[model samples]
Target: MSSGDFSLGDFVQRALPLAILGLALIGAPLLIFEPEGLPRMRALSKELAQVKAENVELTRDVAHLRAEVLDLKDNPTAVERIARGKLGLVRKSEVVFQFGKGR
Candidate 1:
């Protein structure tokens, strides 16, 4: 009860068990409430963050596509250029020629 009666060994014996019990109490949440552990939680959190980042990137891409669609609707030249490049279209007077390298 008194410090005078407690030897160093006695003090350590009492303190060590109390310290272990305190650590166990502090660790209970990390053991039970967490699905796996701190590492698993960190990995899941990182995955969620990456997904959210990719979602943001995809949303930006959609916005860019919408702007391009609006531009194509308002500009006939842009539509023609896209069609000419992507679909290989040509005007009535345009000549189509193919030269083979094996000649």
Candidate 2:
């Protein structure tokens, strides 16, 4: 309590505000601009958005593939189309035509 004595209570009263202010000064910019803070959050948000878009596209592709699979399983015409296009299969009664030069 003497005028020349350093006191814990007095130090806390004076230094706490400065410490709090300094921390805020250092922390506010991190919240706004630092790569591990706001910037990283924004990057993650952008990545999530991209992943969601890709998921939608993949969902559509999966649906289309499923429908095609069902068609190939049940629709004779679809089976024939795939066989002719992918496997080069022909009906027994169909004539084979070759116009290109043989390798």
Candidate 3:
């Protein structure tokens, strides 16, 4: 066909594919990288990082408590003091008296 004889059918066929491609290009970024999509991923990443940090802190605390437990186990004086106060044990020379509001 001649350039001046461009028909509506030919224009629509060319324009439809271009319109669909344009819409796909525009919508792809919104679907993949828009705030609604990316913000949740970013928030999850931050939460994962915080949870990892808390895990590390809890691990350190557990290690410290384990060390303290080992120290108490190895020390007789510490064990004796804990037993005397917590278990209410007394030596042979110590006087045992009960003078309290309940008694």
Candidate 4:
């Protein structure tokens, strides 16, 4: 209540919050508007989304492969179909007519 009677505890109590607030105000702009700060955050966010999409695509691919594996394991016809289609296999009595050879 008296002039020039400031106590140490009162000065510290008042100055501490001001110091913290000053640091926050100064640090916020340095982190938000600085070229390497906000841009890096944005770039990382974009990369995270892209990676998530790729992970989804990979998960779908893995599911398709797993289904194919199940088919190949449980079904004999599936293996025969694949062999015939991909390897150009035919039954012993089947005829293969090549209409577009060396054209």
Top-TM-score candidate index: 4
TM-score of each model, paired residue for residue: 0.63, 0.71, 0.54, 0.72
| Best lDDT among the predictions, by candidate number | 4
Assess each prediction's global lDDT (C-alpha) against the native. Answer: 0.91, 0.94, 0.91, 0.94
Clashes of 1: 0
* Candidate 1 local lDDT, 3-98, one digit each (tens): 578688988999999999999998987696676877788889999999999999999999999999999999999999998999999989999998
Show where candidate 1 strays beyond 4 Å: 1-35
The sequence of per-residue lDDT tens digits that candidate 2 reaches over residues 18-101 is: 999999999898778866888889899999999999999999999999999999889999999989999999999999988998
**Clash number by candidate, in order:** 0, 0, 0, 0
lDDT of 3 by residue, 6-101 (tens): 899999999999999999999988987877787888998999999999999999999999987997989988888888999999888999889888
Per-residue CA lDDT of model 4 for 1-103, tens digit only, reads 6877999999999999999999999999998978889998999999999999999999999999999999999999999899899998988999988877675
Poorest lDDT segment (10 consecutive residues) of candidate 1: 30-39
Model 4 Cα RMSD, 1 decimal: 3.1
Better of 3 and 4 by lDDT: 4
lDDT of 4 at 57: 100
Q: How close is candidate 2 to the true structure, as a TM-score?
A: 0.71
